[model samples]
Target: MTCSTLWCALASLACLLAAHNAFAALSVDATPPYIKPCRKSDPELNQCIKHSFEHLRPYLIKGIPEIKLQSIEPLRIPKMVMDNGHGAVRVRAQFSNITVIGATNYTILDVKGNVTTYKIELALSIPRIETTGSYEVNGNVLLFPVRSRGDFWAFFSNITGSGKIYGKEVIKNGVRFMKTEKLLVDFKLTKSKFKIKDHLNGHNVIGEAMNQFLNQNSNEIIEEMKPGATAAIGKHFKNFLNGAFLQIPIPVWLKD
Candidate 1:
């Protein structure tokens, strides 16, 4: 894909990881070391649940087999398609084999939740996220038309994000589960760098110029890709969370 497609990786990474922060289950004393259980009755419930993320952070990197959390480190996304037809930057990119690094390395700046209402707001900081992948993309970027198939790498740093998740209770076999209805994500990055191996028939001069253009306009380019990125991640993470939440009953980690 063109270098402009690279920043699409940063679009929802923080939001994806933030989904894990909502994963507290049951009571602390009976749960596995990797799973942090936040009591619904705790007076400082929000803070307790916020710290639960840190307690589970180390486990999320390698994944906890018992809990069925797959490795998040170098997380693999089978595919991602982003489209933006209206903007200073307009492009549609399809990304695959998208290996992402550094999603687990985050600090929870703040967390607010109303367990009864099943709504959560999370604020977080990620030092960086590195991505490598292959893709097919075609579209006009600003004044340039781009079409290509190639390997791409991108690095984003000083990332900060905020998001909210909404869910509703479901009853199953006398147990309770929270089914994610929607997750809204938004983020900003202080710096980003992008690279693509082949483009414009491998003409080094033309490719270098394209890279320069993409990096120079990274912010606006990323903005163009955000809507699609948000919807894509939101849809994927909903299923992912549903899988995890179903496996761990709500009564185990949360109570009414």
Candidate 2:
């Protein structure tokens, strides 16, 4: 990402996180935070953003290479493990040939300080996610390496989540310093569309049973995956914020 784009993304994220933190601490007692309308020429806000961005570039760059999101096409999964029913069974799968749409639209409600409150809309379609891992049921009573392809659609509304910034203060060379707190985000999924197309494997009976299990339990499976997805998006923003605000001096506004 270019420097300006990265900074803008981080600033936007900081605004989101600050709002979420207040909401969490106040237990809905706090008024929703709003993004301050300020021009690039605005003295305090502009200076703070510029200084903070410059200071954070060092630490921010370190983590950028590590932040990975393949939202475009053909998302590859070397291995994915799913376990349900109190560890009674497990499925290891590899996902590929994925196509997604409407998965990255974020509507910002408010931006105050380091916290931001927003609603995100996401819809995903995986044409085929190949499953080629062993399934073990009840301590290896049923064990086999299977293959399957799934076509799934997931959609949700008003997905609310939170991200909190945590850090400490210190003095270096007689100058006060503040660092970004760990990123904490919370999220949930309500209703969505999930489907499995066809199952293929060596064992006929077990394959058919597994396919039926997935078709019947798609809702449950989606629910199980929601939190991880939410955390991932939240963490993407956190990485932005960390690179923007952490390595350098903390902005004066976040101090309050």
Q: For candidate 2, what is the total of clashing residue pairs? A: 13
User: TM-score per candidate, in order?
Assistant: 0.84, 0.38
lDDT (tens digit, per residue) of candidate 1 on 21-112: 34443332344566456777888988987787777677767665654457677677787777667766677778888888876777888889
Model 1 spans > 4 angstroms off: 1-30, 199-206
- Write model 2 residue lDDT over 141-223, tens digit each, in one string: 12544455543333344444334556556454444344455565544334333334444444456545655665566456545
> Cα deviation of 16 in candidate 1 (Å)?
11
Best candidate according to lDDT: 1
